[model samples]
Target: MENSTVPETKKDVLKMVHKFKTTFQRLLSRENQNVIETDYEKCETNTDIEKKVFGTQKDWMNLFEDPSEDAKCNQFAKHIEDGLKEAREKHLKCEILIPCGLTMRIARDILIMSESEPCGVRGCSLIIHLQEKSNCTELVKLQYDPTTVSTFEIHLTLQEDTRHVVSVRKMMMQLTGCFKHSTYKSTPKMLCLAYKLEKQKLYRANC
Candidate 1:
């Protein structure tokens, strides 16, 4: 299969995860100007599993404070809440398209990447498919270029002066802001954000 094609099956998905891990690790060290410990144990274990066992391991140690000043989880939560409150007052609609099979994973990724304390995104990506029994047609798109490859684009639209568009833009900016600072030193806060995300997996499992 061509590398450009995204995998849909479990086996192919596992392959993609391995590939992404290699690329992401290289990017992490080079971009952050700091070395992120690789999950060598995972690499070994993953090799032992059957191709059908495509799911990844649950490692809580990964979510640690990098070197940032604030808690990434909190920052992400705030980002989501603030964006939604701003959009709600103006009645704007928002939508986000994350990687396939990576909805929660991407959310966790955002929490770590934001590296800000007390963040949430409930209202930011809420899609209004139907409003007052009417269909909405006015829409804008936001895309996050992860792996330096953009595949998903979220379309959002609003009908009134509710400043919905502005909110969407704000959320997108926050989510994508870290890429420009890839070369900066990792802060303690950044590591903590990563840690929280890994720990939260237990809580998220039931949801």
Candidate 2:
């Protein structure tokens, strides 16, 4: 009888997967139908930069899921925002080696974050923290909820990390699961990152 139940459970799981695949395909197909459906970079990159500099204007998503592309993007963006904040508090600068070019030195100060509502939106207020603040620019959005705690957003005018400057937001947001938690005595914040500059694929964003 237990073995019979196992097959039924497998069938149920398959049904769910089928539903998900169908829905995803439908949405993707509709997106593809546009006469000039741009590349995935176009699909994922932030649409605006100047208007998005604050980081407090947005939440993680509009209306769809935990691990969907949108969800993953938000998670990664939150990670970069929080990591930079933590790293800055402990060390004046956190060094990120460019894939092949110069190193980026990010600065963080204790004043960067607070237990209460942050001052003047983070991306704009903290423009002083980025290494490329001049040649390139940034915008950020942050959201906090009694339930979700915190989720952050960033838009950049330069491509220090990816093909398009704004596209880096997707890479940053791709760091973790679309659904996550921080219940047990508060979760960990990264104070350091040490990705090897030469071996791009060896680590998960280094540290």
Candidate 3:
């Protein structure tokens, strides 16, 4: 009886050790997984910080460079040139419009027009070269189709004179009307406005 009892106790001890080993392995795996997740989070945070710091490095470097007569204009032209290239690659007609500066009312009107359209009509696209109050240029793309337009809106304060505001609003209304007409006719038309250049010429003539 004593001999049999000893063997049974040995078996129980072995079983206990095996259970402990399995538990330890599972806990270790869970700890490793947690560590991996924490490291990934840290990596993502660092990447975002790096992007914020380095994204506009060219603009920052330009501060020390000698300024040219057409440096800003050239930069704006380059952005437009690139936009045109992209449009060509996509086999879509592109129109470039300049509203002088984006205003809240103009933006609201654009949003309303865009939301009124349908979706997935691969007809034409719009490239907006927006010049901000700070003289910074931004490229905005809008799908100009019968079905749908992009809903992205850039918020900006109205800083232009009353006359300028009225002109811009008129231009927007005309463009919106064009969109509506195209939708009714099922024929999308490319909208183009060189308003800024024309306005500049008028100013020069007045001077």
Among the numbered candidates, top lDDT falls to: 3
lDDT of 3 by residue, 1-207 (tens): 788797456545544653464355445534422111112122333335323332333322222122541253344334445554464345333333322211211222222223222331122244444333455343445544437443332222212122344446546766778445331322222222111210000011122
Which candidate should be chosen as best, given TM-score against the real structure?
1
Clashing pairs in 3: 117-147, 118-147, 118-148, 119-147
Candidate 2 TM-score, C-alpha based: 0.22
What does candidate 1's lDDT look like per residue over 1-207, in tens digits? 765464335445555664575456445533432212222223433234322233433322122334231244444434434443444344433322221222233344443332321222221222222122154432222222222332222222222222344346445665777335433232101000111111111012233
- Assess candidate 3 and give its TM-score to the true structure: 0.18
Off by over 4 Å in 2: 1-48, 52-67, 93-199, 203-207
What Cα-based lDDT does every candidate model obtain? 0.31, 0.30, 0.33
TM-score of each: 0.23, 0.22, 0.18
Sort by TM-score, top down from the best: 1, 2, 3
Q: How many clashes (backbone N, Cα, C below 3 Å) per candidate?
A: 35, 12, 4
